[model samples]
Target: MKQLYDQRISCPHCGHHIFVSLDASEGDQDYYEDCAACCNPIHLNMHIDYAINKLELRVDADDEQVF
Candidate 1:
């Protein structure tokens, strides 16, 4: 039950907004994505709240949380 969706997120390194893939069915995950503007790896921490049908994401650069 892997549902993939494109989610817009800001790059921590360059502050550029980019769309990244998100898999809600994975429940929760931690991964990295390269920023389109800066080419820097951004750490993504995802949490799914099934009860509320919502997804919470934390984008980070160098282990520092951005949002």
Candidate 2:
């Protein structure tokens, strides 16, 4: 598996497409990045599935609530 990779995601606030760099070497991670278009903080949750050799990314706005 590649330690470093890039994924394209849409900003939850502005819906603008952007590329984000991810490092699988760090394992699962939770971070935030400012959206290029909307300038809102984007919550990024990364999960690595070693069994399936897959990386899953969840993108959302920081202010989102889960019900």
Candidate 3:
């Protein structure tokens, strides 16, 4: 399996599309990265579902995203 996966997400600040690199080996993670378009912070959350064998991601602004 690939350790890194490319995820496409929209920047909550400027509504621009951006691609982020996520590491699957970490299992679960939360981090912030600057948006390439808006130059604002983008919150990213990722989780691994071993049962379905898939990686789930959530992107938000400075607040937490509700499922």
- Leading candidate by TM-score: 2
Runs in model 1 lying further than 4 Å from the true structure: 65-67
Model 3 clash pairs?
none
Candidate 2: tens digits of C-alpha lDDT, residues 1-67: 8899988999998899999999999999999998888888999999999999999999988785789
Question: Cα RMSD (Å) per model?
Answer: 3.9, 1.6, 3.3
**How many clashing residue pairs appear in each of the predictions shown?**
0, 0, 0
In model 3, where is the ten-residue run with the lowest total lDDT?
57-66
Which consecutive 10 residues in model 1 have the weakest lDDT in total? 58-67
- Per-candidate TM equals 0.78, 0.90, 0.83
Clashing pairs in 1: none
Task: Quote the positional error of residue 10 for candidate 3 in Å.
Answer: 0.7
Off by over 4 Å in 3: 64-67
Give lDDT tens digits, candidate 1, residues 1-67: 3478888989988899999889787679999889877899999999988788778899989764578
| Ordered list by lDDT, greatest first | 2, 3, 1
The candidate with the higher lDDT, 1 or 2, is: 2
